[model samples]
Target chain A: MKKTINIPLGSQHIALLEPVRFSFTCENETIVGVEADVGYVHRGVELACTTTFKFKQVGYVVARVCGLCAIIHSTCYTLAAEELMGQEVPRRASYLRLIANELDRIHSHMLCLAHTAENAGFEALFMRTMKDRELVMEAQEAMTGNRVQFDYVSIGGVNRDITTDIEALIRQRLGLLKEKVGEIKELFENNWSLSLKYKGVGIITAENAYRNSALGPLARASGIDFDVRNESAYLPYGELGFASVTMSEGDIHARNMVRLLEVFESIRLIESALDGLPEGEIAAKVRGTPEGESYMRVEAPRGECFYYLKASKGQYLDRVRIKTPTFGSVPAMIEALKGANYADAPAIIASFDPCLSCTAR
Target chain B: MFKALLNALKNLFSAPATLNYPFVSSPKHQGARGLILFDEPKCVWCLKCEEVCPPGAIRFTQDRESYAYTYHYNPYLCIYCAECVRACPDKAQALSQCSELSRPTSDPFMNDAWFALEKEAEDSKEAVKELKKAKKTEETPQP
Candidate 1:
């Protein structure tokens, strides 16, 4: 005879950044089943986008969807708007957009890494990752005019242009960050305690990842070669020699390694983008209103962020639909949590790097 | 184990990584978006900032009788996108990277310099009406 008990992990927890509830049914110490509720932070952002904001202002409005990936949100919407209006973005503006997006990815990946280390009870690693992350934040601020929510990408072009002084600053800081990340990467790979806590835990097989439609590093870790940056022309990712990082294990360690390796790729892309920076107008003359429907997708730090816009020849939009990456990954997250030990649950949750704000909004 | 000890020794000799906040501010990269600065004299009361603001952070109002315009900016609601700064034709509003956003007891933004223009326009309308009346009375005597 087996005795099972239900334990609730969160609606509010010390480890979680946003509100999400999880109830795990455990047989002794092993979790037999898991259920998640992800609507705790929903503020009706989709409804507000269509009803309240005009087509021109929706780019900035959608930036409020997620602070970590604000530039991606604005850029995706701007791309759709430009497509509908038949406007052409200059090469220089596209390069600026690419640089901002990659910088955002670097900082976001570092934060997720820090959070995972903190969950594993390694206080020093958490602090060190955060300290090194500041270098990327400094680069972001110098170029975008804001640290987190930059409002860098507008409809026709970007809001701020990068000067030569800012360019030198970015190159210097990224050089320093690359050296520090190498140290952090070595620790994640070789440290005994982290290996014990992270290795072979919360495994998501390639089949499970595909069946549940997992995205981003989650899918990549499971040997799924799907990255929006490779598929979409929303940005000049290919011209900058973008490469997707993939692994086979699909465990917590593999996920961490995938993000770690991608950071290096992101740095390379940023450097190449700067090296080939073009000379042209930063903005184009946009005229008329957007008519008909358009869909846009961009590779956010987490996964694919998709936006759907339906507009007439009016100032306001007819409908605005946003499909955030975390929303699509919830089912996959639940699948990974089952059969894991109760004590390892927080580590598993942090490994997914779920952005509940983005999911709910 | 040796690597752990080596890292510990390195950290012990190096300066602390943490910053002393409020005593010593963290270093900000260039082009940081901070508090907003409003220049009232340059504003023409076009209300473009109010229209373009995503969060409705900036509001412009007019007193119909006096024709005076007043502006209000709620720093709490502002997202610091600087869309308002870009939308203004006169460049009346700008962003300051070093200025901090503080909570005040009362609203700090209110301006009304367009009252004189409104009054002059009203007086000219009245003068035109009086001239038409004088012309009508003279024509009536002739008829």
Candidate 2:
């Protein structure tokens, strides 16, 4: 009776990172078509940013869009609002923002890597990766004064200044993380079982990635060479000699490798930013309200997190439009799923590292 | 596989990575964001903290007869961002963030009470404004 069977992969599944549903049309364990639903977790964050909250309070509001990249959201929005208000952020504040952002990237990348390993049925590696991830979490908590929702960045400048004690702690933790990541990298690379699940399981051609407009490591893994960090000067990444990591494989393994490599780069950036940290007032005296329309892009751990802010000289913004990376990468995700084996669906989807909450918001 | 065996042996000897919660306490670092502590005596009743708090965790209810302000804070509603502390006047310094905030009361009454208190705060302020306006009219007489 039924020729092609349809299998659904979740709004709730054991392997998914967030609440997202994907239906795969399979012909004998090989996927022929894919459909995704990413709007299940929408919280109307964009509408709230404009209507409910004032311009000053919107920074904290947008930070709740996604827990993993909370600071990144605030940083992007703060930068946009600052541009509108003509606010000059202090040098030390810029460097501190950079450090916090890099730390966030490291921790977020680790989380994705850990989940990818877990979804591939490597629970031991997943646990070990999460254990090492605590180093960055501790460093972040000590530096930013909060763990997940770090309301560190405000409009004019950052809320808190980085101290010498916190600096040393960050350096120490990153050092330990560097060694630990090297070991994880080796395991991801050399382990025969991980290779079987990852290496060529879910391949996206370079053309396909570019055509579908894949973002972040998903695009970079396919050799597209697109990274928002290198493309923008939102933070002090240029001064820190930031480099984007890329791979040619375009498969599950390549994505994991890209994340692993980026973690190392993120660590280096944080340490560098710390060493060259300047001294100045942490926050500037904010004088005026934002008057003009301005857009900002920050390299969130997932991908390019963009904010289009329009304010007409008022406490409440006229409009706030957010373009999250997961939303951009969904088309590419469905494309990748079209030819993948049904068994490797979890691994492939995990490698994409979709944040449905961020997407839906 | 050899390295895996070695790691297993080493892990067996080493301490567990996670803390034993409730038995041994978790580590609290310096400058960790915690509770918002208010000093009633030092407070100038300027209501800066109430105005700047993002979550409306802090509120002040005004008594009509005495025209005195009573501070009401629900720790659960607070995001602990310290925006209120930053907004507070340096001279007043009435609001400060403590290093740690454990779970406060989780009862629904606290949450429901906050809604009632918020309404009362607005109503009381409105009542006082009307009273002042009425007094001014009386003082001016029929103009």
Candidate 3:
């Protein structure tokens, strides 16, 4: 006898903030096929950017698309506008932007790790990780003056400069943060329950990850050595000696490990940028209309966030297109979900760190 | 089995590393962006705060006669970005370190009742001062 089993998970799962529905066809305990339906939280941000607002104001609106990866959205949009205007931002502004971006990455990856731990029933680890994550929030407040939607980046350059006091404060905090991250890593590595829950679950081979064009730690965890920071060489990342960390496991455990290691790498990048801190104007004068379309990409906490901007003579943009990382990885997520156990569905789903807001936007 | 039980027992007595958040408050830095607060008297009606706000949370209108300012804040829309606080020309008109940003209503838009009341009180005080001045002038002979 042939029997069909259906397990449907809605967009309102406790583990997810945004809505994404998943239907898993399973036989006994093993998933046979998986289907996903998104577009629940689409706010038409890109559509609004082109019609309603000027090109300069769109940066803030784009940043609001996702609260976690706001910096990447703003940075990518700024880079596109800069390309269109044919303006090179000053060295100081670029370095300051990189500092804010790295701080954002630290906070975002830490929150994901905390959420993963919470979902895995590791409350102690979740609380401990979040406690350590507070340092980045404090550092962000010190630098950009806000923890979330940092309105520090502008069209021509950054709105603020990093003073001697702020630089010294960041260095001191980073030193302490490095020590704490090490302790947390040790704890995560030693926890047997965590290992059992994540290891060998949601397996995505390096070859498959590349074939699907996975970005950020998802691809890197599968041993794909591709990071836009290393490839594109944007801003301070060009000057810093940051290497993409990769692993071959390609499972949930490997992805989590990759994120943890990337946090340390982010600290190193921030330190190097601060060491070679240049003294110059943070912003440059920008004028004239952007004539043609320009494409810019940045490595967000999740993956590659790309923006395509077209501007005419008027202040309003002709068209603004955003391709977020989550959108790119959704196909790979459905592939990973196929043939997996029904119990491991949430783990597999969260393994990609699916930001439905970014995807829908 | 015996060895595993022994190891578990040994781990159970180790010191608890987590901090009690509610019972013990962590040391907050002076530059922390906490909740926003407004002082009515020091405001100069410049409206610079409204101009620089990234989110359109702050609304200000100038009074007709008194020259005092009326400011409205929709706490629901406020992301606590601190742009308004940073843009405040008067240093006293910025956000405070108190971040208890909760409200009873389901609507996030009506969360700024405290700020609304503060602005109203200032307006009422200005109105009363004008009334007292008019009363004094009426008691005296017309010049």
Candidate 4:
């Protein structure tokens, strides 16, 4: 009766949004081991960054790395490029960047929550969450002129500025979204079936989280207090009173709770940034090319997104390395998947919200 | 359990959340980037759009005798980031979200419609310039 069987989850599956394969070894119904394959979606973004795109345009090129966190990719690349050129972004542009980044976080978190709900067989909850997510999408489109892949951030500053009309629209939509998120939070917290599927399942302890270098809501759910927004001086997150939300439990429920709580914090940060929006030029004049090598890190929805650029006084970059969060969190995801019930596998995977696009790119 | 029952009751009275596409029309925000638009007259033939396009979606060729340029656009390769739109000095390139999605094709002519567009624009501008020169000659009183 102690026989082991191999089960392959996906390079393609209904439960997965992107192509990532996980082979699980299960003894009866309980998983004993996991092996992940994450190279399905890689389109040679690193090679393209150096060969195809110029320094001025690489900001937008990196935005194509991951659709969900496109703004963050551009922002991080722009920050590094600005650092290389010794460019000082305007205060208003900094505030706008903060606003856009937080909006992206809200939408991405909602998407993860929706996917989790769908994977758990709560089809109604998935639909409800997606409907609410549209509010944030509307705000993003109104601000940056695109729903996803905004290409909002440029090297010196942002490409667009906010007007009173855009501000009012964002405020109104965020207000509506806050209410809907509250309802979703109640469902996640008190719903009996959700609790049964999520509570104490696929747990990662604080030690494992640290050992595996897990990050974003995954690490925070394990009580590890680390967020690039708090630590980095890249944007105006500090002035906006950015606070990283955390929870002690590291279950699927705990991860969902961390995301839900962080949505409120992100809303608060956006409101504060918009309230203190300074009046100035949206972009700065660029006179010189980026020369020196520099590195930048940003907190994407899943975790830390890092960019390393090496330039040598040319229009083309010498080297570009993007180390996305999902790349580092794969080991942790495997560790969590091991010892979990095979039936609970999809739900656990959905909880991590592993973005293979970002991982492979 | 009570909340779930109440939620089910509330859902019974509410309208369906899903959009009836093609019948009700899809939702698009005003600033959403959907289609690439060109103003051939306003284009200065600088080739900045070609230079800055991330996926090489744009192709440009010029005729030396006419001093007119031909531009081609492949929507399939375009990422729709509107980098060319931002880079346009004369604001010749633009994006609109309300456009219909094209069926994907590998046909060569389908991707080169932008060349025909630029050619039409150049011919029209040439005609207008000739007409303006003729009117100037007529007003000069046989000088």
Candidate 5:
């Protein structure tokens, strides 16, 4: 008889939102060894960026890599390209970029929370969270002019200006969202049944998180106290008074708590960003092609999204290297799954908020 | 569980949250990025929109004999990023974006026709370049 049985969860599974495969070698009911394949959704975006699109157009090309974090990808790429060109972005443009990025974070965190609830077999909570998410979606559409793919970031600055009417819409919607999120946070923190599915399950210790290089909410849950936004000047997060949320338990529940608290922080940041939005032209004139190599990293909803651009003053870039958060979180994911119960697999995976479209691209 | 029961009961009597999709249309907000609109007379034939469009949704085919240009747009191929509108020169103001989204086409050959047009657009540009070179040579004295 075989000592252990291998069970696969993904590449096509009911629990997954994107295509990623995980093979678990289980000893009885516990997963003993784990392997993950995050390349199932690869679309050859890097090759297309270098060979097909011009430097000015590559911002739009990379935005299609991950739908949930589209703005982050474009913002990171635009920042890097601008660095190569020595472009000066207006103060107002950076604030608008920050606002859009935080809105992206808030909605994405809500989505992961909803999925986690659904995975835990709490279907009603999933629906409720999804319902609350629409408020932010409407606000985002009003601000950036699209529901999902916000092509708001451009080479020098942003594409759209913040009118007073749009500002009022965002404030009203975010205000409603803040109230609703408070209720949801209470439910996540106090609901007895939810604690069963999330508490002390699939824990990643602080040292383990450091060793495996887990990032974003995953690492923050493990008390890592590391966030790309606080660590980098890619955006104006520091000036926006950004503060990262963290927890010590390092379990599914802790991750959820971190994400929920981060939502509050993100909403506050957006409100402040709006209030301090300087008066200036939305877009500065883009005059030249990017030359030489430049690197940039931005805090996407998942984690740090890094972009490497090497241009030789040409229309098309020589290379565009993207390193997404899910790719970095894989080792930590495998580490967490080692001793977890097989039944907790889906819930644990959802808590990571893995965006395989980003990783594989 | 009792709290859940009360909430469920109260929610059952409340009006539904979702809109009636078939009867009530959900319109995007004002200035929502959508379809690109082009004006023929206002265009200076600068070909700037064609150059900046990422997905090559906008193309211009030049007449080889008359040196005139015709603008071609495929809404199906467009990503609605509005880069063309921004790229259009300020004086021309020939390009703008409206909030109406692209509708799905019933034509089976829509994509095929677009692909053919893309190839023709490239070939026509090449032909125009060759014609311009010939004209320049005819005017210059032979070495």
Candidate 6:
């Protein structure tokens, strides 16, 4: 029998930090079709950047577009400006940027995992995870002098230098974090109820994930094995040897595992970066005319973030366009949610770790 | 299923792995970026901090009579980059430790107040001597 069921999951739910609406058509308890409606918190960042803000000032504006991935936004935007000016950033500055970026990934992924635990009614685990997550924030604060929105990256290169003390502090913290993460992972792995709830839920086929162009852990969990860190090899990532994690199941459990495993990889990258960091100036003096358009991409917490920028002789930017990972993953999310139980909708949504602020920006 | 339940129950007897946050504070490292502070008495009117601030959160105006600088820091736009602290040549010592800055509905331009510049003890003495000398010279009469 063909019947229509409207399950409007809205602009405000426990599962989401930002506002987004999803309408699902379900046959009995299983969802048959899904529709997404975003733009609840659109501040028109691109428009604002082009209209009133200058090139140097746009970094601050772009950083506010998404608080979780603020550093990535600023880094990518600054790199775009650098490319337009045909400038080469100092090697030390690039490493510092990489350190900040990796720390951000750790914090962001920990938050996502904590949220998942919260949604699953594991309050104890949630609180513990958040507390442990603060270590990364502290590391970031030590390095860039701010927990969020470091403003460490500038057009020419990074704005600050990492001292020997700061490098040693990062190394010590990573050592402690390794032990903490192992404990947390053991706790999660031992919980049978968590396993049952997350495993085999919201399954996305490898073929569909590829066809819809999903990126980051979402694609990798479905055995895609694609990462901008490997393909694009930006910043100091090329020197660091790390493997992209993947699982064939493509379920909620697999995605969670991929994120969990990637956390360690990020830690290793940070450690390796600190060990072999080159000595150089933190920033270069940039002066010239930017006449053409250029594109830059970075692997953000959610997925791949692509930035398109156009500059003229004037100080004000001519055009600024950003393609966030949320936009790319929304379609795949809808596809994954189809045929899942209605109760599983929130779990499926949270699995992608959607960042609506990035999307609306 | 019964065996799975038994195993799950066995896991409950293990020690809880979560941190007790309200009762316990998170670990702090030496270089943690806690907060920003301003020293009212040590400022010069250079406005270098204002020039180097990426977010334009710091503002200062000159007091011509005193030849001193007045500074303001708006926490709303302050990304806490500490560039201002580094750029101050006088070591104005304006920046201090602070942690609880983020607030609800922060206004970027709200920070506007005057901080008095600190005068060195020797400079104060020199000023007094100069004033007395000027008075004596005036009393002595000029040709």
Winner by lDDT: 5
Instruction: Please say which candidate is ahead in lDDT: 4 or 6.
Output: 4
Better of 1 and 3 by DockQ: 1
Per-candidate RMSD, Å: 5.5, 1.3, 7.4, 6.6, 1.4, 7.8
Which predicted model would earn the best DockQ?
Answer: 5
Worst 10 residues of 2 chain A by lDDT: A271-280
Model 6 CAPRI rating: acceptable
Expressed as tens digits, the lDDT of each residue in A86-205 for candidate 3 is: 887888888899999999999999888887887777776677778888888878877876778787787788876777788888888888889888877775677788888898888888
Q: Evaluate residue A158 in candidate 2 and report its C-alpha lDDT on the 0 to 100 scale.
A: 91
Q: TM-scores of all models?
A: 0.89, 0.98, 0.79, 0.89, 0.98, 0.81
lDDT string, candidate 2, A184-215, tens digits: 99899988898989988889999999999899
- On residues A159-178, what C-alpha lDDT tens digit does candidate 6 reach at each position? 66788888887888888888
lDDT of 5 by residue, A1-361 (tens): 8999999998999988879999999999999999999888879999999999998899999999999999999999999999999899999999999999999999999999999999999998898899999999999999988899998999999998989999999999999999999988988888899999999999999999999999899999999999988888877888878888999999999999999999999999999999888898888988888889889988888888999999898899999999999999999999998999999999999999999999999
lDDT per residue as tens, model 1, A126-224: 989999999999888888777888888988898888899999999999999999999999999999999999999999999999999999999999999
Q: What is the TM-score of chain B alone in each candidate?
A: 0.62, 0.90, 0.49, 0.61, 0.90, 0.52
**Poorest lDDT segment (10 consecutive residues) of candidate 5 chain A:** A232-241
Give the better candidate number (3 or 4) by lDDT. 4
- Candidate 2 error regions (>4 Å): B105-109
DockQ of predicted model 6: 0.24
Q: In model 1, what is the error at residue A189, expressed in angstroms?
A: 0.6
lDDT of 6: 0.80
Q: Grade the docking of candidate 2.
A: medium
State the DockQ of every prediction.
Answer: 0.52, 0.70, 0.17, 0.46, 0.74, 0.24
Question: By the TM-score metric, which is better: model 1 or model 6?
Answer: 1
lDDT of 5 by residue, B106-125 (tens): 44337888889889999999
Chain A TM-score, each candidate: 0.98, 0.99, 0.97, 0.99, 0.99, 0.97
